[model samples]
Target: MNESISDLTVRKHRGMWGWILISLLIAVIVLAVIGEIVVHRAMPILKGRVIETLSTRFNSRVEMEGFSVSVRKGLEVAGDGLRLYPQDEVVAAGATDPLITLGHFSFHASLSGLFVKPMHVGTVHVAGMAIHIPPREMRQQTPKGQRHLGKIKILVDEIVFDDSKLILGTIKPGKEPKDFELSRIVMRNVGPDAPWRYDATLVNAIPKGDIHAAGTFGPWNNESPGDSTVTGRYTFDHADLNTIKGIGGMLSSVGEFSGQLNRIVVDGTTETPDFSLDTANHPVPLHTKFHAIVDGTSGDTYLQPVEAQLGGSEFTCSGAVVNVKGKGHIIDLDVNVPAGRIQDFLQVAVKTTPVVMTGRLRMKTKLHIRPGPESVSKKIGLKGGFTLEQIHFTNPEVEDKVDMLSLRAQGDPKAAKPGAEDVHSEMVGEFVMDAGRLRFSKLNYSLPGADVMLAGEYTLDGERFEFEGKVRTKAKVSQMVASRWKSILLKPVDPFFKKDGAGAVIPVKVSGTKSAPKFGLDLHH
Candidate 1:
C-alpha cells in the first residue's frame, strides 16, 4: 500500500508540469499575433513621421506616394514626382526652377538603429533628378547654426544619383553656368568622421564632352556642400576645350589637385604634365608642364617655377596668368635659357637661318601677351637682349675668307684653309617689339676680319627684314677685295664715302626674307 502511494504522487507531479508548459506556449503565440497587427497598423504612421521629419529638417516641401516597413530593408520609401525647394524660394515670386527635382527617389533605413551608436543612412537612390545651383552671390542663404538640415543629428553614409543632371553657376559674374550629366553615381562614407569617396563619368550637357574622375572628399558638411576639401585626380582625353567657357581650342590634359572650396574661392596646388595647347595656326599642339598655386578668389594662377622643352632647348619660366573676364587674358612671364644651340633656332622660330650656326645663347626676356586672335603671338610686346658667343660657322668659303684675314698680320699662307677660323665672333643685340614688328638696336657683330654694326626692323609674321649698316674690313679682307678689278668698279664711289678706320669701310644694305636673305654692298645705303 505504501509503494502504490509514492508512484501515484510522482505521476501527478509530471502531469501538472506538462499542463503548465502547454499554457505558456499558447500565450506566446497570442502575443506574437497581436504584435504583428500593431506593426501593420503603425506602418502608416511611420511613413507620415518620415515625411514630416524630412520636410521640416530640410526646410523643403516633400511628399511620398508609397511607404512600408520591412525586417530586412528597415523603413522603405519610394515615390515619383518628388521636388525639394527651399522654404523661402517657394514663397518667392517668379522662381524659375526648383533647387532640385526628383522624378523617382528611394530611401531605406539603416538597421544599426538597434545598436543606436553611430548614425548611418543605409542608402539614398535619387533617379531622374536635376539640381540647379545658382551663382554664389545670388544663392539663398540661411543663417549659420540655424539651418534645419544643419541642426539634424543624423549622419548619411551614402547617396546615389541615377541618370541625373547637375547645373552649377559660375563664380564669375556675367558668365553662363556649367552643366554636367551623370549616370548612376555613387557617393559613400559621407559622415563627418568618414571620408566621402565617389566615382563617376560626367558629360557636358551643352557643348558635349566627357570627363571621368574617382576621388575622395572630406570635412564635408551636409548643409554647406561648398565648404569642403577634395583630394582627387582628373583626366579629359581628346576633349573640346570650348565645352568650358572662356577656354577655347582642343585640350588633352591630365592633372591632379588637392584643394578646399570656401564659398567660391578655391585654394590649392595643382600640376599638369604634357598639357597640349592647340590653336588656329598650330595644328600640332605645343606641350608644356604646368605647376602652380591656383587662387580662384584673385582670378590668378601664380607659377613660381615652370618648365618647357621646345626644340632642343630647355626653358625655365615663371609668371602670373590672369583672366580679365570681358577683356580676355593677361600673361606676364620671365623666360631664360642657360645654353641653346643657334641652329636650333630654325626648329622653333618662324625663320630658316641663313647660315649653319653653333653657339651658346644667353638671354633675359620679358614677354607680355595680350588678348587677341592668332596674331596674338606676333603682337606680343617683348623687351629683351641676347648674346651669341663661341659661334661656329660651317661654311667653307666664309671660313676661309675670315681665316686668311686673321693670318694677314702673321703673313701665313699655309694657314689658308682656315681650320682654326671655323669660328671667330661674338654677336649681341637688343630688341623692342611693338605692333607686330621687332626693332633691333645696338646690334653689333665683331668678327676676325670685319666688324658690322646694324639697326633694323623685322616683321615677325611676314618674316621680312630690312637693315642699314657699315662693315669695316681689316688688311686681308680689304686687300683681297681691292685686288679685284671690282675695285675699279667702286673707284669712283670709294672716294666719296671712303673712311679711314681699321681698314676700308663699306656701306651695306640688308633686305630679304628671313629664309633667303640678301646683302648688298655699295656706296648707296
Candidate 2:
C-alpha cells in the first residue's frame, strides 16, 4: 500500500511539470505572433514619415506607389514610383507631370536612427530619376519664414543616381524643354540646408562631348533658382565639332565655373588640333581662352572676351551667341586683331592651296554668322576695315606687274622692263561681305611711287574681280613711256592727266579673274 501511494504521487508531479512546459511554449509562440503584427503596423508609420519628410523639404506634394522596409537586412528601406509635384499651385494645376520623379530607390540605415531627429542614411541608390525645372515665370516661391522643414531632418551620406536626366523648361509655347542626360551623379552630404557636394558626368548636346564635373550644387533657393550658388571644375573631352553642320574639329576643354545656374561665369581653355571650315577643307590648329557668362535658361553664351589663335593668327573677340525663335543660334561677334598674318586667315577662309597674298594684317570687324544649312563661308558676314602692310602677291606674274607699274610711275620707264622680283605694297580697305563676296568701299593701295584709290568686289572663288579707280603718280604722263618718241607723243596729254597736286592722275580699271587680272585705263571715268 505504501509503494502504490509513492508511484501515484510521482505520476501527478510528472503531469504537472508537463502542463507547465506546454503552457510556456504556447505563450512564446503567441508573443512572437504579436511582435510581427506590431512590426507590420509600424511600417506604414515609417512610410508616412518618409512622405511627410519629402513633402516638407521640397515644399511640394509627394506621392509614392510602393514602399517597403526590411529589418532582416539591417534596416534596409526601398520605394518605387515616387513623384514630387511643383510647389506652384498654378503650375501644378496645369501640369500633367511632376517636377521630380524617381522610378526606384533603396538605402540602408541604422535602426536607432528611427528614434533620432535627423536620420542618417548610407548610400542611397537611385535609378531613373529626372528633375524638371520649371520656367521662371512658373516657378513658386516659398512663403516668408517657411523655407525650412521645422524639426524633422534627413541627412544622406551619399546619394547616387544612374542614368538620370534634367529638363529645363522654356517659356516659349509649343517648344520642348531642353533635356540633358546625366549618366552618373553622386552627391555627398545632402541635406536641406547645406550645399551638396556633387560629382556628375553628362553629355553635352551641341558639340557632342562628354563632361565630367565636380562641384557644390545647392542650398536650393526655391523662390529664385537663379540665385542659388554653384561652383565647379569640369573637363570636356572628345568633343566633335563636326556635329555642328558647317564646322569640324576634335576639341577638348578644361574649365572652372561659378555662380547660379542661370548666370554662370566660366573661364576655360579649348584646344582643337584639326579645326577646319568645311568650305575651306584645310585643317589648322585652333586654341582659345575665354571668359563667358552662360544663361542656362535661354541657352545663350555671352563672351566678355575671347582670345583665340588660329594657326599663326591671333585675335580677340567679344560677343553673344543668341538663340532666335525661328532660327537656330546667331553668332555675332566683334573681332579685333592688332596684328596677324594674312596667310593664316586665307588658309582658313579660302579654299586655294597657295594663298593669294601674304602680309602683316591689322583688322577690326563685326562678324556675323546666321544659322542655316549653308556652309560657314557662305553664311559668314563681315563688316570691317583692315590694313595690310608689306603685302606681296604670291604669283610671279602679278608681282612683276606691280613692280613695273611702280617704276613707270616714278619716271623710270626703262627700268620697268625688269624681270619678276619681290615688290612690297601696302593696302588699307573697308569691306563688307555677303555670300562669300567681299566688297571694298574705300580701298587705298600704294607701292613705291604710285598710290591708288579704288572701289572693288572680289569673289571668294577667285572667279571675278572688277575695280575702277584713279591712279596718281609722282611723274607726269609724258615720262610714263619707255620710248623717247612715245614720251614726246604723250607730252601733249600730260596737262590733261595732271590734277589734285599730283604729277599725273589717270583713271584706271581692273577686271577679269584672279589668275588673269587685267589692268587698263578707264578713259570714260
Candidate 3:
C-alpha cells in the first residue's frame, strides 16, 4: 500500500512540469507574431531618418514617394520617385536645371545590420537617371582639395541601371562640348575585392549613330585611383549621317578603345555611302571607306594612316590636330592620291574650294593649316606635285579663248562640246600654296600654235584673279598670236614677228578670273 501511494505522487509531479513548459512555449510564439505588427507601425519614424541622412551626404535636397520594409520592418528601402538635387548653389546662365536627377533608387539588406554589423547590400537598382555636367566656363574653378568624379571612389556590389543618360562637356573653356547618353547601364562585381565589368548602349554618338559596348574595368584601387584601366570594343551600324553636327552626312563605323577611360587610345573604320561637297543640298553619291588610328586626349587628336576611297579616287593620309583646348585647331597632314579624277575628289576634300578640275591625275602633298584672328597666309602652307594625263580645260571663258586660239591656228572653233573637243595634252607641275595664294614653280602649256614655259602666283579664292609671269613662247610671235589674216595686228604688237630664231618672250600681266581674263602688257617690266 505505501509503494502505490509513492508512485502516484511522482507521476502527478511530472505531469505538472510538462504543462508549465507548454504554456511558456505558447506565450513566446504569441509575442513574436505581435512584434511583427508593432515593427510595421514604426515605419513612418524610420523613413524620416533615412531621408534626413541622405540629404546631408550629397549637400542636396532628397525626397521619395514612400517606403516599405520587409524584414519585420527591420531594414530595406523600397519605393519610387527618389530624387536628389545637386544644383543648389548654381546660378544658371539660362533657366535653372538640375545637375543630376534620379527617378528610382532602391536597395535591401539583412535586418541584423541594426545591431550586429554594417549592411552588406546584395543588390542595388537605379532607373531613369540623367546626368548633365556643367560647362567649365560656367563654374568657378574648384578648390585644391575638392573631390572630382574621375578621382572618386564608390563602394557597391552589383548595380543595374535602366534608361540612364550621361552628358559630358569639355572642361576647357570655349571648346564645344560633346553630348551623349547610355541606356541599360549594368555593372557587376564592383567592390574593392572584385573586378568590375560593364555593358551598355550608347545613344546619339557622332553621325547620329547608336553604339553598343562591353568592357571590363576596375576594382579601382583607391591607393592609386588614376591607374585604373578600361578596355572595350564598340559597333555602330547604319547610322543616319544627316543628324550629325558639323561633320555631315556619313554612315557605318566600328571601333575599339583601350586604356584609362578618361584618356584612351582608339582605332576605327567608317564607310560613307553617299559623300558630298555640300552636305545641306545637292549631295553627290559616292562610296567611301576609311580606316583610322587615333590617339591623344581632350585637347589633341593624332590621326595616323587615314586611308580612304571615294568613287574612282583613293587617298592615304596622316595628320595631327592640336590646340583643341582653347586656341582653335591647328592641322597637319601628309597625303598621297596614287590615282584619281581631279574633278571628283579635290572639291569634296577641301569643302571650301569653288574651282572645278578635269583630268586623270596622281598627286602627293603636305599641308599645314593654322587658323586664327591673325593672317591666313602666314600660318598655312602646302607643298605638292601633280601629274595630269589627257588633260582638258573647262571654264566657259577659257573655252571661248581656246576656241579663238583654234580659229587663229587653222582649226574649227565651234566643232563640239568643251569636254569632247579633240584637243588634248599631257601636263606636269610643281606648286606651293596656302589659304591666300597658289604659286606654280614649273608649268608646261602645249598646243598646235603655242608651246610655252610659264611660272606665276595666283591669288587663291580671291574675287579678282591677279597674276604676273614670264611666258617664253617656243613658236614665233606671229605663229603664236597671229594667223594669215592677223599678221597686220601682230606686226605692231611684236617686232619679232618675221624673225623666228629664238621665238619671242613676253612679261605677261593677267588680271580677272577664269571667266573674264584681261591680258595687258607688263608696264612694270
Candidate with more favorable, higher TM-score: 1 or 3: 1
Kindly provide the TM-score of model 1 when superposed on the true structure, using C-alpha atoms. 0.62
1 or 2, greater by TM-score = 2
Score each candidate by Cα lDDT. Answer: 0.59, 0.83, 0.58
Tens digit of lDDT per residue, candidate 2, span 149-263?
5344566789999989987666765344556799999999887889999999997877998899999999976555545788999999999989887788899999999998667
Spell out the clash pairs found in candidate 3.
none
Candidate 3 differs from the real structure by a C-alpha RMSD in angstroms, to one decimal, of 11.2
Worst 10 residues of 1 by lDDT: 275-284
Task: Compose the digit string of candidate 1's lDDT tens values, residues 1-525.
Answer: 999999999999999999999988998888667656645764665555545545545556665545556543455556677665544532353334555678876677644442443334678787888865544444335344444542333456678888987665446753335445776677887655466898766775423556676788666433443345666666666666454342345555566667643222222222222222221122222345666765433345677766655445566778877756665567889988677665554333333334345677877789888765544544467788988888765555455554554454232434555455453678899988767577998678777666778889876543677988977766433243423565446455544444675555666777777444466674565
Residue 338 of candidate 3: its Cα lDDT? Answer: 88
Candidate 1: residue pairs that collide: none
Point out where model 2 deviates above 4 Å.
1-43, 68-76, 89-97, 110-117, 140-142, 148-153, 170-179, 418-421, 512-516, 522-524
Which candidate number has the best TM-score?
2
TM-score, structure 2 vs. true: 0.85
Q: Lowest-lDDT window of 10 residues in candidate 3?
A: 145-154
